[model samples]
Structures are given as structure tokens and as C-alpha cells.
Target: MDVRTLEYFVAAVECGGFTKAAARLHVTQPTLSEAIRRLERECDAPLFHRVGRGVVLSEAGAVLLTYARRVLKDMEDARQSMIALRGFQGGRVTVSAPPALSIEPLARIVGNFRRAYPDVTVVMLPTEDGALAAAAVANAASEVGLTDRPVSADLRAHPIGSNEIVVVLPPGNALSGKGPVSLEQLAGVPFISSAVGTRARNLLDESKERGIALQTAVETPHREAVIPLILEGVGAAFLPWTVSREAESRGAVVLPLLPRVAYDLLIVHRDQPLTAAAEAFVATALGSSPVGGD
Candidate 1:
């Protein structure tokens, strides 16, 4: 019936008598007896057989005793798990992000969170662009998301920082030392472009509407290959400043774009109560310094 009733029944069975169970439970014997009577009435079966100076369990009593112990144990385990989650000692949080954001702020935040809460597991779900990342959070696929912008109205966004878009060129290109390259200069230049729906591709498409065109020498969906392609002089590509810096260290020339194209980085989630692990993750992300070009 109720947890307290089950507890009383179990105590009586374990102590072999209502009198001893009442003593152990710090309850009056009459109170314990009444509780057990109520339980038996609810079940429509006798739980005990009276024997002189002691009691023996009925057939129904044996079945009820087994289940009662399991229920109590399960309740206790649930309580302990909640405590662990609240204390940030255990649990997992899932986060979704595009590749560019994942490289800068998200990667830095995850590293910091893991160091502080080593017991908490962080799961990453990769998406192609800001819209997909926002959709993942809206559909409950992830608890947190990092994106260039939030596309879903149902989600709330936190401004973490911004990443400046930069140009990545092969070593010894003519435009390498020409200060910040303008959109006009890139017209007719061979470029390594990502898929159409990517942030960089979308920006380039918008630029095309304004009469500035970039010729695509190669197009691929895999962003990891963009830097490698640039290294081999396949074509120049656009990348976030943080990623371009890494490419620069590896012999690729990095230059800022004219007019300083930058995208706002956001952390998004549904407007509802979050689990303790997710809350901690959001707090960690908000507290960390902004990464990438200012």
C-alpha cells in the first residue's frame, strides 16, 4: 500500500513479532499492529498466522515480504542518485555544436568542465550548422548547444562570444602579405568551399548577391579536409580565426578578411528546467573567456 506500511510489515517479518518490530522502529506495538492490519485488509489476504508467544508468516506474507524489501531498496538507491547529481559528483550532459564552434569555445569549455567535475561525462553531438544545432536542442537531442546563431524561436540563447572569419591560403600566395584582403580581391580566385548549407558557404552566397563572386575550385562537405587542401595549394578557404591560426603554424598563410566578417557565438537551450549536470555545464560555459578572434 504505502511505503510506511510496507516498512512496518517488513520490520515485523524480520523481527519475528510485532512487539519486537515496534521496539526496533520506536513505535507503539498497537500502532504497528494496526498498520499491518490495514495492509492485510488492502491485499485481502492474511499476512501472518498466530502461534503461541510468536508469529509465523502466511503464504501471502512470504510474497509481500520479497517485494517490499526490493521496493525499499530501490527508493533508497534513487535518493542517493539524486544526491550525487545535485552535488555534481555523477551524471552526464549532452551538448550539440557545429564544427567551428566546437573547435574554439565549446572545446575550451569542455576541457575546463572535465577538469573541475571529473566524474561527470560529457557527450558531444556534431551538427553541420547553427540551424541544425538549434534544432537538435529543440528536439531534446541535446541539453546544450553551441551555434553561430539560434534558428529556433522555442530556444533561448546566451551570447558567449564571436569568431571572426579569416582566409586560409597556401604558402607564398601573392595575397599573403597584402594586409586584410577585400571581397573584391577574392573574386575569380580559386577557392575550397564547404557544402552549401555551411555557415561559410551561406555567407559566400550572400556575398554573391552583392556581385562579389568566388570561384570554387573544389567543394566538399568534410571541413577537416579544407585545411589539408589549402596546404597542397588546391584552393584558398575561409575558416574561423582559431582554426586558421593552427593552419598558420603548419605553414599555411592566414590573413584577416576586409570589413572584418564575424559571427556571433551562442549557447542555446529550451526554456525549461534543466538537470543539475546541464546547469553546471551552462554555468561553466558562461564563465569561460571568449575564444577565437574578437
Candidate 2:
């Protein structure tokens, strides 16, 4: 009948029954039961039937469930939108980034964002999946995300930066001294790879596109873990230029990819209108000169 009734009903459905839903919702079973009863009466249809051990959705219930979830989600988003506009100094921001950027570039962005928005809490997550897109689609995270790509059409994606993909070689390897690394150059050498959400995956796909045979000696989700294998000469890898640059400063020679492969960094958000805090966060990421373009 309303947001509360829909929520109570959905929770009851997901938790399998009124008793379980009441426990989860921290409410009395009869209270939740009454709400579902009201919902069914409002629709003038029996939504669920007691089927031995638990409740099963009736045909009408099946249809109502779909609309109920949407209404609940919209209600939640409405509250979130108002919270954003409240302009509270203390708030939360969840960010998802690729592994390498999560360590360096994303860290820097959060650092600066913290100083500017000191009371805001920043949550940074690194993943091999399209976490940014997935989060936005599910409404499970902050509206702003930094990622290599926004693969979901339900989100708006803006290419914000580019990260270098450098060839990492082990010490004493024959090609170590080469100023630049190329796919052809690493042809026979075994490769170390990033597990997912990485330009490495894209690189692997490119190899497939070109019909280039490849071998991966090691694979890791974290670039920090990937680098040590290169140090051990396990095989070479392609990682963010930031990692390569750090290596270069530490006496590890990093060379550009000969054919010029680059990781395009994109900022993504839900396709719908954004919250005020989210808008501010977007403005900050877009306008902040953390990469020293200034």
C-alpha cells in the first residue's frame, strides 16, 4: 500500500516468512504480518498463500513483488538524495577503482578529497570486476566511481584520465635493457597477468583479437603482488604507469609499450539524476589537479 508495507512484504518474502522477516527487521511478527495483510487488502487480491512450511507468492503476488521492490528502491534513493542535499560535513563516500589506481591515484584523490571535505568518510574498494558499474546499477554504493571503464549502459561514463601500461621485465632477462617493450618483443616470454578489471585483461583480449599466442606464468588481482614476480623474472607484465614510475625511481627500468597501449581511466555514475553530495564529489574529482596537470 505504501513504502513501509512494500518493504515489510518484500522482507517477509526474501526472509522466507513473517517470523524470519520480523527477526531480521527487528519487529514483531504480527506487526509485519499485519502490514502484508494490509498490502494484500489494498490490492484486493491474495498476494501469498501458506504452502505447508512457508509462504508462496500467488500469481498476483508475483506481479506485485516487482513493483514493490521498485517502490522501495525509489523510497530509499529519495532519502539518500535528501541526505546529500543536507550538506552535512560528515558523510560517507564509497569508491571503487582498479587495483593499481586504488593504491596510488585513488589514494591521492581520497587524500585531497578528505582535506577539502574533511568530515566526509571515504571508502575505497579495489576489484577485478566492473565494480563501479555494478555498484551504481545496484544502488549499493556512492554515486561516484573511478574505474577503467563503465561497461554498464545504465551508468554515465566520462573518460577522465589515462594510465600508462608499462612492460615489466625481470632482472637479467635478455630484453631487460630494451628502452621500450612491445607485444612482439614479449612474444615468447611468459607473462604475469592481472586477474580482472585490469588493462591486463584488455591486453589479453587484444592478443586474442590479433590471434597472438600468449602464456601467463602468474596471475594476481593486485599489482603489488604482480610486481614481485617480475622482480623474480617469472615473466613480464603490464601495469599502471604509476607502478612503473615507482619502480623506475627505485632503479627498475620501465619502458613504454611500443604500440602505445594505454589504460583509459573513466569516472562513472548512475544514469539517473545525482545527489548533491555526489555532484560535489564529481566536481572535485573532475576539477582537482591531483595529477599535476596544473
Candidate 3:
């Protein structure tokens, strides 16, 4: 199969549609469609299933996607290797991280990395799911990932730091005066929670698993809205201690959970070899100094 065809196929999966992929590749829709068709013919199987106005990957397509990404990544790595032999002048490193958990430190790290290596371009992939952080690295879509969740055994992860998860309450709420509130105490109160699949949502699920039937007052995807909603007396919610500290100054009462919970931030990458720029990033993040420091 032609590498170009595989490139088009992967682009379709990432962009979510042929038209979008075509626009992304700066190619005509017909050209993109023809390339995908050729790929399907070579594989002798339909890779995508037409659903509504868009297409979803078929079982065959999903299988092909995994190998396609590896092949593309290998090709890129080979090219970057040659570029590095001459001089490490210009190279790109893509990094992914869970959105809510990594806002502060990752931003600092990226800012520092750019200032230190001005010629090295850093691409930050936007992702909300914490799991995607590690998956991005495994799939070769990104060179490295910053995640708060555990990575699979096939991947290598480095401990960066940890963040405390705390409960936030409104000023007039009964729990406001409490020092450390147990999940049991908040069981009767309506709970504002992060949306499904997010780390905060996982904590809420953990509470339920522990036998606390916390009523869902509101479920939102907006991490920024969590404190504001609590301040408005919408309901209590759990947030990172650093974030909760900011809310505490703004009239929201921050209290530690009965059983303290903290998630470790890890720098994750595939077990396989990484490009030079990726290794540099890993070293910088793992170093004792602040992200981007000498």
C-alpha cells in the first residue's frame, strides 16, 4: 500500500470525515476519496462504515489504523533522525495531556521548553480524557503525554508530581464550617460533578462504589464552571487542591475529603525508542528544576 494512501486514511480518522481530512491535507475531496478507495481495495475489506452524514471506522479500519500510525511514525522518526545528524536545528514534538488536571504545570513546562529550545516546535494536542494522554503516545500521534492516571504496562511512565483532590462548598452551606467532610456527610446533598470519563467523575464513581449515593445535582464538562456553580449554591464538587485554594480565596470553602485523594501526574511515552526532541522533553520534565529551567 502506498504511504500516501495510509496518510489519507489516518487523516480521515483523526479529522473525523473525508471532507475535513481533505481540507486538512490540502487535497481535493475526490482525491482523498480515491486514495481511501485504493487502500480499501488493496486490503480487500471495507475500512469505514457510513453512518449518518459521517463515517466511523470499521473493525478492519480500526485494525489498519494501528499499523498505519506506527508506519507513519517510523517514517517520521527516520526523517528526523537524518535531520538530527546534520544538526538539531528544527524539529517538532507533539505532546498530549488531560485538560483539567494539567492546566498549570504543563503550561509552565511548555512555556519553559520553548524558551530553552526556540527552534524546536512543540505541538500541544487538545484532549479532555485523561486516558487519551497515554494513548496519544502509544498511537504515535504524540511523542509524550502528561497524565494523572496510570498507563498500561506496555508504556513507560515517569512520576512528575501529585495533586490533592478536595471538596468545595459554598459559604452558607452546612459543610462550609466542617474541617474534613466525608463522602457520607455529603451523601444527602446534591452533588455537582464533572462529566463522564473525566478524572473528577471517576472520583465520584469511587464515592458511589464506597456506598455513598451522592445525588447528581448537575453534571458539566466545564472544569472552570465547577467552583462558580458551587459559589452559586448549585452543589458541592471535588477539585484539585491548587484549584480549590483559588476558590477558597473567592468565598468558596475548601475542605479535604474524609479519605484524602490525590492523583499523581506522570510523564508517559511508549516503551519504544523516541525521537531526540521527545527525549529532551522527558529529561526536562523529570529534572529537579522547574519545567524549562536550566
Best by lDDT: 1
Candidate 3: tens digits of C-alpha lDDT, residues 85-186: 778778888889876545656877777777777888888887776688889888888878988788899899998777777888887776666688878888
Taking all chains together, each candidate's TM-score versus the true structure is: 0.70, 0.69, 0.87
Off by over 4 Å in 1: 1-86
User: Model 3: residues >4 Å from true position, as ranges?
Assistant: 51-53, 172-178, 208-215, 288-294
Which is the winner by lDDT between candidate 1 and candidate 2?
1
Error of 1 at 20 (Å): 54
Model 3's TM-score against the true structure = 0.87
Error of 2 at 62 (Å): 12
Judged by lDDT relative to the true structure, which candidate is superior, 2 or 3? Answer: 3
**Across residues 1-294, which tens digit of lDDT does each residue of candidate 1 receive?**
999998899899878999999999999999999999999999999999988866889999988876787566445445545856566577778899988778888889999999988988899999988788887777565778998864667788988888888888898888877879888988887888888877678767777789987888998988899999999999998888977887899898888888898878889887866667777889999999987575
Ranking by TM-score: 3, 1, 2
User: Which of candidates 1 and 3 is the stronger one according to TM-score?
Assistant: 3
Query: What is the Å distance of residue 230 in model 2 from its true position?
Result: 2.0
